[model samples]
Target: MILKTFGWSFVITAVGLALAVLYDGWTAFGIVAILSILEISLSFDNAVVNAGILKKMNAFWQKIFLTIGVLIAVFGMRLVFPVVIVAISAKIGPIEAVNLALNEKEHYKELVTDAHASIAAFGGMFLLMIFLDFIFEDRDIQWLRWIERPLAKLGKVDMLSVAIALGVLLVSSMTFATHAHLHGGAHADKGETVLISGIAGLITYMIVGGLSGYFEDKLEEEEEAELEAEEAAKKSGKGGASAVLLAGKAAFFMFLYLEVLDASFSFDGVIGAFAITNDIVLMALGLGIGAMYVRSLTVYLVRQGTLDDYVYLEHGAHYAIGALAVILLVTIQYEINEVITGLVGVVLIAWSFWSSVRRNKRIAAEGGGDFSEKAEVSTGV
Candidate 1:
């Protein structure tokens, strides 16, 4: 199972290194490997969050997520999306944008930096919504219930998210528009326009994200109903076909929600990666490798039952997400490096792992007496 899971990753790595060798030999290979490792380390929390969703999906969709979903994440979002962003930002044609990246590497950084403000805006708002939803929504778990009642009284986080996003847009627009005379550039007006554009993106994300959440809840309800019906049918010796069909449908919608969640997570990673390198091929190769590792890590989490074993892990990831969202929002007013964002996630996830281990040890020690009692009783039997 492990080999099957990682086989495609190895193939991708081999192909990436082979291409790197053809282009710039061992040095390029090393760079790609290093970048891939860096990306993987930074995205550990992403895998955990993904696992929570992936566990709800059926086997077939899980395969699709590993294959087609990886393609979209690594190639479509990481590679093509950056290029498209560059083209728009630089006010150049696609070919010219490629040429600019290849020839004018130094100037490309400025374009990337300019692009960050807007991308950060969208990423920030989206993540804020995620954090708010998690904190506000009622989960079956007890420890998490404390915040739910208070958050629920405040109303839907989605509504608050929309209002906050619009406020950000209005503030950014006012700043840019008012200060237009203070800063002169090739596209001064374009700078002001980004604020409005970013708000539109945020609104779109809100609509999609909210609808996805609603659908997910509805699916869960339907699955519960089906399960109850199935239980009744088995007791009465009746048909179970309808229940099975409902289960399949529930899994399908769960899969869709997982993909949407993945896309949201990728938005920041994809945009942040452009800061490191503008070469679409290299970006795709590097982030693809990272995406592969994250997928493997997710499967490992499921197999290991990491969340069930380590209670604090999810809480830490959500906290980190919230922090990242705030950082991204602040970047609209002040620049924060992508390295910093990546490092923040790495540190948070590392801390969570350590905390999980500590927690498990404590649990084991506390259960030691019970185990001894059971051993004595068994021996008597």
Candidate 2:
């Protein structure tokens, strides 16, 4: 299973390293290797979140995610997205942006860094909405009961998630974004830009996430109908039929949501890549390889039923996402080290994993009679 899951990633790693060596010898190769590892470390929580979503998708859609989705992630976001941002922000054509990236690498990096405020505002708000929605929803499993339970109660209010997300956007735009340095220490009030970008982000999340949910509900209804028919057929001595899977509009919208979520997660890593090297080709190779591994890991977790085994893993990933969203907003004014961003996610996930292990041991020692299920219903955090 591991080989089948990670085979493509291993192939991509070999090819990417070869290309890096051919690009500028061993130094470029080493840089690419480091960037790949950095991306993987920063994105471990992403794999967990992705697994939770991908498991709901059908086999065909899962293949689409591995193939078409991979192209969009590696080239569209990792490569083309930055260029598009530079083109728009620097007021230049796409070709000029490409030339600037290749020739004036330092200048290109500066443009990308200067554009960070807008990027942070957009990605931050989008990610914040995701975290808010997750935490606000009432669930049988509460990872942090003290906070999550109250939030869940308040979540009964209409549009609470959207209201809180918009409030955060407004506060950040007025405060942190106003003091942000643009164009390499040239201070300017970025409040207007931040507000506009944040609104766009919030609107994007609403449209995409809303449509996905609607379609997913339809898919669920279809699945239930199929299950009913199959059960009836079985009782009547007819052969059981296969359950319907996510497809059509449902699958497409879900796929779209996944890609956008991936883009939100990649914002920090794409910008942070500049700190390592400004070579566009090298960055694409490195980050692309890392992305493949993440997708592979997602598939592994889903196939192995890791989420069911360690239910708190999903909770951990969401908490990490919340930390990242706050960090992105904070970075609008203060420069946060990439190391801190990466470590915060790793630490939270590690703690959750430990909690899950403890829970499992306690269940076994107590002669488990659905104690795990019972524990999920308990008010303890």
Candidate 3:
């Protein structure tokens, strides 16, 4: 089942292998392979999160995500984005950035990693919001009832996530300042950098989320009208943006949301890949392979209704994302291992998966062999 949907991933893997062999030999090939696995392992949460949103979209948009979106994932986020980061941070042209990546590889990596505090701040905050929104929303099923119930109750307090995130940023900033001062190096302004980037991330999320939510309301209206065929004024989402703004506006916004979400998720992997190899091309190829598989898994999850089946899967993914967000912020002052970051997500997801399986067995037994029949009505949170 996975193989059929992930055929494109196989093609990507083969192409990456061939490119690694042709360009840098077997060592590079091995590095590419490791990078691919690293990306997949680190980004399983991304796949689930994407699926949660993708299932809301129509088939056309879903295909666009798999096809056009994959190109952006591989080229834009994996390569050009890094070059742009280096270009802006290093005050060099894109070509110069590429040259640095190729020629002065160590310096290139340093430039990339040097910008980590801000990157982590921005991405971590964006992700923290995602996690907070998920757990804060009133879900029917409470996987971790003890933790989630209180959060849900607290969510009624307006801007709880924002307040909590800002508080963490402030504390992180203070800790960062003290750490930099004591360490006696170029870390003097890291706390300030984190604050600025974290705010920018928060703003980006509000804009993107706001736009998407507005369009979603419009789409829902259209969905309601179509359900009754009561009016021709309401256009189907498939027919395009329904004369709302411009052509493809709805889908385009969805596309934007997905791309930004993917970028935030990829920030870690892109930086982490440097630890494995300095070759930008190899990193792109290797990580691109992983990205393709993640996209495939997203599509597979959407088509197979995995989220609906494993009720806690999305919850688990968000919790993993929340942990990652905290870890990213923590890494600003402390050097955290990528392996630990990856493992945290894996462990949370695995526990949730196991819990889901047990849940299914219980449901099956209680419902006299048909779990799906009472699944919708079952109490979950």
Candidate 4:
């Protein structure tokens, strides 16, 4: 299963490095390798979140995610996205943006960096909404009971998640966003840009997440009906209906949400890659390899039922996302090291894994057959 999962990632890594070496020298190769590791480390939690969503999808959609989705991640976000940001921010044509990226790399980096306020506002708010929704929803399982339980009770309030997210955006705009740290040297009035971008992010989440949830509820209902029908048919000595799989609009919207989630995660990686290297081709190759591995890992976790085993893994990932969202918002006014961002996620996930292991041990000592199975049943997995 390991080879089946990561085989293509290995192939891509080898080819990407070889191309990098051929592109310039050992220097280019080193940069590409570093960028790849950077992307993977920063996105580890993202892979966990993605797996939770991907498991609901059927095999065909999963294939589409691994193939067509990788293209968008690599070319669309890693390469062209920076260029587009530069083009619009600098008021230059696409051809000019491309030329600036290739020939005038430093200037291009400055332009991209100048646009960081809007980028951070959008991505941060989108991720904040995800974290808010996760914590706000009442569930059978609670990893951090002290914190999560109260939040769940508050979740009963109508639009609590949206209200909190908007409040945070407002506070950020009034305080951090007004600071003159972004946009090449010192500048003000960034609050307006941040506010608008944050709202756009909120609206986007409402649209994509709303549609996905609506269809997912429908799919769940259909699956339940099919299960009931199957049980009845079996009692009468007849064939049962096959299990329902996620497809049609449900699958499409879910895929869209995943892509948007990826984009939000990639915002930091994209902006940070400029700190490592200015070559767009190398950035794409390296980030592309890391993205392929993330997709592979998502599939591995789903197929191997890792989440079912480590029940709190999703909780940890969401917590990491919440931390990242705050960090992104903070970074609008202050410089944050990428290492700090990566370590925060790793630490949270590690702690969650430890907690899960301890829980399993305690259950085993109590003579429970399998805590994982018990957890699955409790959560309706």
How do the predictions measure up, each by TM-score? 0.79, 0.95, 0.90, 0.94
Better of 3 and 4 by lDDT: 4
lDDT, model 4, position 275: 82
lDDT of 3 by residue, 127-181 (tens): 9988988888876677888788787898999999889888887887778623532
Clashes in model 4: which pairs?
none
**Candidate structures ordered by TM-score, highest first:** 2, 4, 3, 1
Residue-wise lDDT of candidate 2 within 246-284, one digit each (tens)? 557888898999999999999989988988999999999
Candidate 1 local lDDT, 146-251, one digit each (tens): 4544665565544665576567556655654333321113233334555655665577566666565566676777778778888989999986535445556556
Clashes of each: 0, 0, 5, 0
Model 3 misplaced regions, further than 4 Å = 177-187, 230-248, 368-381
lDDT of 3 at 224: 71
Per-residue lDDT over 262-354 for candidate 4, one digit per residue giving the tens place of the 0 to 100 score: 999999998888889988888998898889889899999999988888888899999999999999998888878999999999999988878
lDDT of the candidates, in the order given: 0.65, 0.88, 0.83, 0.88
lDDT of 4 at 243: 43
The global Cα lDDT (0 to 1) of model 3 is: 0.83
Candidate 2: count of backbone clashes, pairs at least 3 residues apart or interchain: 0
Q: Which candidate has the highest TM-score of all? A: 2
